[model samples]
Target: MSSGLIDTKPLAGIALASAGYACFSMQDALVKWMIATYEVPQILFMRSLVIVVISGVLMRVRHHPSILKSPYRGTVVLRAALMLIAWLLYYNAARSLGLAELTTLYFSAPIITVFLSILVLKEAVGAGRWIACIGGFAGVVIAANPSHSPHLIPAAMCLVAGFCWAWSTILIRLVSRSESTLTQMFATSLLFGLACAVSFPWIWRTPDAEGWMLMIGLGLIATLGQFLLYEGFRYAPASALAPVEYTGLIWAFAYGYAIWAEIPAWNVFLGALLIVASSMVLVLWERRSEISARNRAAA
Candidate 1:
């Protein structure tokens, strides 16, 4: 019974992580569609308004009125700031880059997260995991193919966004150890909303009806994705949930091809395969190590 419970939690976490990635991919697609007609700041401002409302409702539902009362306010605020910058870079890149390519590049966040975990949390990574990280990075390089002349700027933006995302993920992992998920959500919405508002004066644009709907949808979807993502961490270790995030690549491919008629180059698929394989290997290694430790404890 205990073992069943143990297995269930991580499985649930993986499911949530996969679902979160899907939601995020959908949100990205919406952002890409809208960015063609609107500025990034306008989208950010409108979407952030939606997130603030949704997050507030979520906090109320959880009976946590004091959403800002987190022990790790500084860390949470910093994380939100990193995410805001990452979002700006990613949305800008999405304006020109194919979705599949941008996603593959951004998925490099997992590799960056692993290294950040070591540096920030002082977590020890085994040699095998280190090798897996290298493999994943190599895949990113292959997928990105900096040698490609025209994509240089967008690719650089994606890399920088991925690095910022990695830092944000590490902060989320750290803060989640002691902070409430609702608090985290609230902080993100509040801080990011404020940031967007400050930029709104400079880049404000009136949206059409269709644009408003898309902006609202983007915010709501992103809020749900953020909730599921943080909840996944609550249920499972970061190592266990990390690989499930690769599912976003599948969604990205579908959305790219269907919506924009954008098909990635062959090397993109090859690199994506490597990234996914390395991530899976890391997940399996962590699961095995966890089970082994549990068995040793029982013995």
Candidate 2:
């Protein structure tokens, strides 16, 4: 809303989201693999520490002079909290659920966002949007294949993570209205790094050489992934760009098989496809609705 100038320069949000998802999906696989040999606390601590250092340098060069002098503290906190919860859930999922399942569940963020905006932001929710939301959740049911057990712990965590992410999106919208994207991102990165560093002392465990490299890779991937995610939203609205969230399932599936030799069952693939298709349909529907509204206003 800070209008120096306004021009729609196309920077494919979907593509950026896809790339970020791949990086994230790969990072999950790598981190889980490391967890088998190293403690979770150690991995988290190192990852947080390394990302902080890496992001600090990047921010210094990109937006030197002062980082925190801006008005982005709230956005930073929201983004960090959302990301922290999502990672915690996804990491937990990595321990039990297959990558594809976890990725599919994570895509539920956009659907959750749709509803959250309705309740919190008081955004208009038309019949079409409602249909899409229902369709998306149905697809999730298919993907999750939830039985009576309620033992689908990872899926539940992913859902909780999605809720946090939706709130974070709200925070981002509020923050971006007044703050620079770079500033918000830098602050969030710095906060997360510091939080992890502070917690590292309690859960410190020495890792082997391989573990070190893995942690470094995890940190680099996470940093780049987050930066790209912010860039994605900068380019496109979440409704217009949200469907790309599903592509991570493909990446997750590929990594699961290629790296871990784990293959998803038929039901998993089917459910995942349903979720992806439903989310995409919702995205397209939202775009059409916006276009129609613009045309009406013009007329």
- The clash count of every prediction, one per candidate, is 0, 0
Residue pairs that clash (backbone atoms under 3 angstroms), model 2: none
For model 2 the TM-score comes to 0.78
Question: What TM-score, over all chains together, does every model reach?
Answer: 0.83, 0.78
Task: Find the 10 residues in a row with the least total lDDT in model 1.
Answer: 1-10
lDDT of each: 0.74, 0.64
How much is 258 displaced in model 2, in angstroms?
Answer: 1.2
- Give me the candidate number with maximum lDDT: 1
